[model samples]
Target: MTSELSWLRRRADKRAEIGPWELREGLRSRSSELRALLEERKLEHPQGTPEGNRVHRFADEALSELENAERALTHAHQRYKVGSHVAVGQIHIDTAHNLLLRLSRPSEIVSMMPGILAIVQSRLSSDDPRRARVEAIAQSPESIGEPERETILDAVGVARQASIRENLRVRSFVNIVGWVAGCLAVAAVLVALMGAVFEDMVPLCFTPYRGLEVGGYVVVCPVAMNPDPKGGRDINESEASATTPADYLVIEIVGLVAAGIAAATTLRRIRGAVTPYNVPVVLALLKLPTGALTAVLGLLLMRGSFIPGLSALDSSAQIIAWATILGYSQQLFTRFVDTQAQSVLNAVSAPNAMPPPPSPPQGATSSAS
Candidate 1:
């Protein structure tokens, strides 16, 4: 008996180790085994005998356990879906990278200043319109003083804006994709809970006539079906009900509420007590929702697979943690992007980078030197 108990404990441990993928494969095996065992027992044993009843009970229990395992796997998949919400916010990083690259173009042009200046000076007498503009740029940059320097800086600013505008369509596409991904995750939670609504509304009846059978699996309607008096058909249009997975609504509700809480917390932390009116109003409105959506998606993707210490809130807490992490993360990311932009600007305006045409010394030069 002690040996048997030890074996059973080992089996339980193995069962605990089974992840979503493993459980899915095992479902097919376990289901086949249960079916075969029942068929063998039915063929060999008398139906009414105690031994036959015991065998049937064992098979039924095994089948029930397999169903439970499938349900647990489904729950894990759902959690991962929620966790991935946070990853959707990665669009910001992608756009930042693209802008940084565009900023490099101006930096590259500035790096070759000596050649450009020489070309402009040599061709200054020519009537070519391009050379004329280049002559104007090369000649009085320092001679005309601080105002001319400011013009150069303004041109750089204009170039950056143009680059951003050029990629507006691509950026917009990314935003739309991100929003759709977030909405799909939210919809998944709703679909999971919708099962409970069906269960509450539909009444079940035990009958020998199965409503639909295909591929050895049966799809049973939740509502009762009575045999037609004259035709004797089992199908009834009015009595049929949609089948829903049982007992998942509570978890779905808890996850959604947790997502909302995480969103509120993120807004409080990132935007502070009040959003700054100086920033774009559209951005201010989106910040809270985007943070919350990313957090919820992140939790779903990461925590759905396992409920660590406890079952339900493990996923919810995961979502909140992601939201908070991302809110703080924006602080670091904002600094990083700014630093990249500044470095590019500096590269475009390096020391003695471009020789100014001979002119009187000016004390009020721009600091970009």
Candidate 2:
């Protein structure tokens, strides 16, 4: 065992004197040396004595190191051959291929051997059996001219730039889609608020007299009416027929579009304060029927009646006017509105306790305590 260890140490020391080519030529002899040492260790350590076991371990380590050194030498020799003959681009390709093999399996050659593949493609002009060996070495034997290398690099650069441009275009398209979605959301909210402000403002049920005299036919104006016996009539035929219901509907739609723009503008201003970046603002005009329905529900919780002087206008006009103001002042109103909603919820949950007093007027100043 001691003799085996001394022999292994001498071989390891001799490894430092050999070049990669010389090492490659000596691989067979070295493998034989390892095999011989392993056999001697096994015969002497049949029962696995401590000294014999130590000799076996040392031989195994030496064998493993020798195998690794052989592979290193082979790769170094291959690279030397490639660098001396192949063009700079081809050399790069060969290096990349060698790295690929190290990282993956031999089966991965189809995808990992692009440089060798390119060389083969160029060699289609000549029918040489030796070209087959280039695949094993994973490099080209013939050096590519400067013009060919430049052409290959240019083509690769162009393809890379095209891919980058395509990515940018996709990103821009996504951003546009997101901005349009945001606009639609804003428009929907504005239309909803408008409907809520005017839900009860217009007369829903009405009556019109069709009775005619013998001499002259006559038509009575539409009069506002309700199904409830307790309800009172509020509007005359003149106001109801002055503009058709369809016209009012149209006005409401137009107002919603304008409100969407106003909302978008307000949002842009708020965003601008936080960041210096700017983009062209476009508003979505389409309004969903559900928005109008939701507005009807919102009307029940509104703070006050229509603003002063707005009463002269039609119901749709009045709604649009109020919606515009609310859109701009949403941030100011939302906080108090949420607090009031919570208060209402609390009052309902505890029916026995008295509801809290309404918040004090914003205009009223309290004396400092």
Candidate 3:
């Protein structure tokens, strides 16, 4: 049993180590396939004619871009292995993605067939028997005139440019969200550290009006400190010294636990997105810190008697329970963020598929009618 467990642990560690390498390999394989396709297309359509020349040019350009992308991916993998700056890895990944997008141009390819058919129909007279040839070529593009080819290429180029812009927009949004989440997480950590170091300055102890059975009122705190019972009617905030830095840390920890649970529950809703920017991961990270902050703030609000009915907590357990509740309540605030993230993910059309073609020009449709 021990040997089996050890083997499983080692296997898990190996899997973790290979993650970046797997990504690099996957991209390399894709680049290889694209390169082969480009080479074949170049062979089929030589530079003897205008369309062939264009094909040759596209193949050369795409191959060059593919090489760049492979270089970027290699650099990224190396940096990832060396534990270099995360932003450097991100830049390399973004470059590779952009280069690959240019090379593949799936949207352009999808638009090409229809665009060619449109161009052919527009140029050839309706009575021309060559119209039948247009349909045949549309089914399987064997040949097209230079003029019609240029028009189709122009339209496809426009579609490719639009796809690139859309990709950039989605990438930008994901980056912004990731940066914001990271900042918030840092802020939460700082706040917790500050509270821990300067416990007296930032005490989280609360004294209820209700007195203890013995006589005086006892202060309740998240931390497990001996309660100091005041002889007076009720112990005020200033008089309480039982609260320690652990109080804030305890609440933060509880909130973090709750947030983790929330994040786990949300995994069902998270769909796998094709883009490099993992929005769901970013949102999950955001929730953790937000939950921590909320937990601390929620306790503070309760201590200040902000919430009328739930002003006073009876014991340390009660305080911690409330912290957990408040921590999970971060979902209430972050749900809107989740919704927006989903919308953004949905807006990102698949890079490997074509979007719907644009509507015909106003006058062109009427003219055809």
Per-candidate TM-scores read 0.24, 0.24, 0.68
Model 3, range 1-369, lDDT digits (tens) per residue? Answer: 999999997776454443345555666786787677778777777788997777777667777767766665554234433212222333333343333333333444444567545543543434444544545546655454554444444443444444445556666776787788888789888988988788767567766655566545566677754455565433544334676767788889899999989988986787766555567777898889989999999988987789997876778889988999999999999888888777776655443233346788879967987
Candidate 1 lDDT over 245-358, as tens digits, reads: 542333333434544444344434332111101112222333333443443343344334343542222122343444455433433323332343233333322322354567
Q: What is the lDDT of residue 69 in candidate 2?
A: 44
Of 2 and 3, the candidate ranking higher by lDDT: 3
Residue 204 error, candidate 3, Å = 1.3
| Model 3 alpha-carbon drift over 4 Å, by segment | 1-27, 37-59, 76-144, 211-214, 225-239, 350-369
Top model number, lDDT: 3
lDDT tens digits, residue span 1-369, model 2 = 999999987776455334333323454454455456455655666546775666556555555555554444444234423212112222233333232223222343334347544544332212333333333334542334344343333333333333333333333433564464466556555644543454334532223322333222111211222221112233343334332333334333444444455445544332211111111122122222222322332222332234333222223334455444434333343234234323333322322223236797765665432
lDDT of each: 0.39, 0.37, 0.65
Q: What are the RMSDs of all candidates, in order?
A: 32.8, 30.3, 10.0
Superposed Cα deviation of residue 16, candidate 3 (Å): 14
